[model samples]
Target: MVKFLLLALAFGLVHAYAELEGTWYTTAIAADNVDTIEEEGPLRLYVRELTCSKGCNKLGVTFYVNANGQCSKTTVTGYMQEDGKYRTQFEGDDRFKPVHATPDNIVFISQNVDRAGRTTNLIFVVGKGQPLTPEQYEKLEEFAKEQNIPTENIRNVLATDTCPE
Candidate 1:
C-alpha cells in the first residue's frame, strides 16, 4: 500500500506540471532598484503548475535573461506551496523569495526578491497571440541594442527569429 501511494503521488505531480505547461507573455518588466525596461527580447512565459484553489496547487517557472542578445539562466525553476505563496526559497537559495497572484487565473504576477533583498516582479499572461512582425522585431532589436537588452535570452519565447504569420 505504501509503494502504491508513492507511485500515485508521483503521477499526480506529473499531471500537475502537465496542466501548467504552456506559453505565457508580458509587455512590461520591472525590478527593484533597477530601471524599468519597457521592451526587451521575446516574451515567452514557460510555466508548469499543479492543482488549484483560486491558484495553483504547485507552480514552477523557468525563464532566461537577455545579455546582449545572449541567453542565461537567471531564474531557476520554483513552485508555490499548498498555501499559495511564492515567498520562499527556490533552488535552495534563500536570497530569492517569490510570491505570485493566482495559478487558476489567466493572468498572474511572480514576485521575487533578489540577493540584495530588492523585490523584482515578473508579470505573466497566457497565450501567444502572434509572433512579432519583421518591422516590429527590428524596431525591438534597435530598442534592445539601445537598452543593451539581450535577444538570445528570449529565443525560446520568440520560437522563431522572424514572425510566424
Candidate 2:
C-alpha cells in the first residue's frame, strides 16, 4: 500500500512539472514605415485562461513556474500588460490544442471561428514568468513599424485607458 501511494505521488509530481502551464501575454511587432528606423511598441496580451480537452484535461489561470520547473497557481487569473494596445479583441475557441508546451513557455495555434464560421489563425504564446527582454522588445517594435502602425498614438492609448485584465 505504501509503495503504491509513493508511486502515485511520484506520478503526480512529474505531471506537475510540465512547462508553459500558465497565463502569458504576447505582442506582435510589425513594421510601421520603410524610412523609419525605430520599431513600434509591443502589444500587450492577456491570456485569461487555457483549457485542454482532448489530450490534456487541465485549466490554468495565473500559474507561475518555479526555477525547479514546477508550475503553481498564485491566483485564479494572471494579469499582464503588454507595451502597446491590442488591435482586436482576444476571442476564439474555448479549447486550444498545444503545439508546444514547456515549463517556461507555451505556443499554441488556434483558429478563431466567428458566428458566421469565418476562421482566422490565432497564435498564442504564454510564458511562465518574467517579461520580455530589451532585444525582444526591439524586435516587436520593428514588427510594428513594418505594419505601418503610427507610433504617435500608441503613447496616447497606453496612457489614457486601462485594457481589460
Candidate 3:
C-alpha cells in the first residue's frame, strides 16, 4: 500500500509540472548592441517547439530546464526581417537548457558558432503571448513604409511561426 501511494504521488507531481511543448511565438530582444540591431530591426518573430514524454527528454526542439536552474536549447532556428526591407536567415545552437518555463516567460541560453569560428552566447528571456493582431500588423505595414523597408518583408516576418494552430 505504501508503494502504491508513493507511485500515485509521483504521478501527481509529474502532472503538475508543465512541459515545454506546442508552438510558441518568440521575439529577439538585443541584449547588447541594441542600437545597431534595432535600427535594422526592432523585433524578430520566431517559433519554439518542444517534445517530451512526462517531460522533455531527448530530441526536443525547444528549450528545456534541467534539475539545476539552467535553461538550454535543444534546437533553435529562425529568421530575421529588418526594416521591412530585407529578410535574413538566423540559425544557431542553443547552449543552456531551460531551467523553468511557463506560459508567461521562458529563459534559455544559446551558444552559436559562425562559419568564421567566432562564437556568440545569447541568453533569451522571452514573453509567451499571441502574435500581432491584424491592426498591429497594419500598423507595422505603415511603419515599414515610412522606414523604407518593404511592407512585404514585414508581412513575411510576421507570418513566420512554429506550428499551425
> 1-165, model 1: which lDDT tens digit per residue?
999999999787555545555544332232222332223332332332223333343344545544355544443434455454444454223222222222332334445454566554433333344454566455445544443445432232434222212
Q: Which stretches of candidate 2 lie over 4 Å from their true place?
A: 1-20, 27-45, 48-55, 60-95, 128-165
Compared with the true structure, all predictions reach lDDT values of 0.40, 0.36, 0.40
- What local lDDT score does residue 133 receive in model 3, on the 0 to 100 scale? 52
Question: Quick one: best TM-score, which candidate?
Answer: 3
Quality of model 2 by C-alpha lDDT: 0.36
| Cα displacement (Å) at residue 43, model 2 | 13
Q: Which runs of model 3 end up more than 4 angstroms from their true locations?
A: 1-17, 31-45, 53-55, 62-93, 130-165
Models, CA RMSD each: 11.5, 13.1, 14.1
lDDT of 2 by residue, 1-165 (tens): 999999998767446434434345432211122121122211223343453222233334432222223323232321222421112222322233445455555544333344455444334445533454566445434433443444332221112112333
Candidate ranking (TM-score, best to worst): 3, 1, 2
Residue pairs of candidate 3 with colliding backbone atoms: 64-98, 65-98, 65-99, 71-96, 71-97, 71-98, 72-96, 72-97, 72-98, 84-150
TM-scores for all candidates: the values are: 0.40, 0.38, 0.41
> lDDT score of model 1?
0.40
lDDT of 3 by residue, 1-165 (tens): 999999998776455334445555453322222222222232232446544442322324453322223333344332212321111123332233443365654544344444445454333434355455566456545544553444544323223333332
Quote the positional error of residue 8 for candidate 3 in Å. 9.8
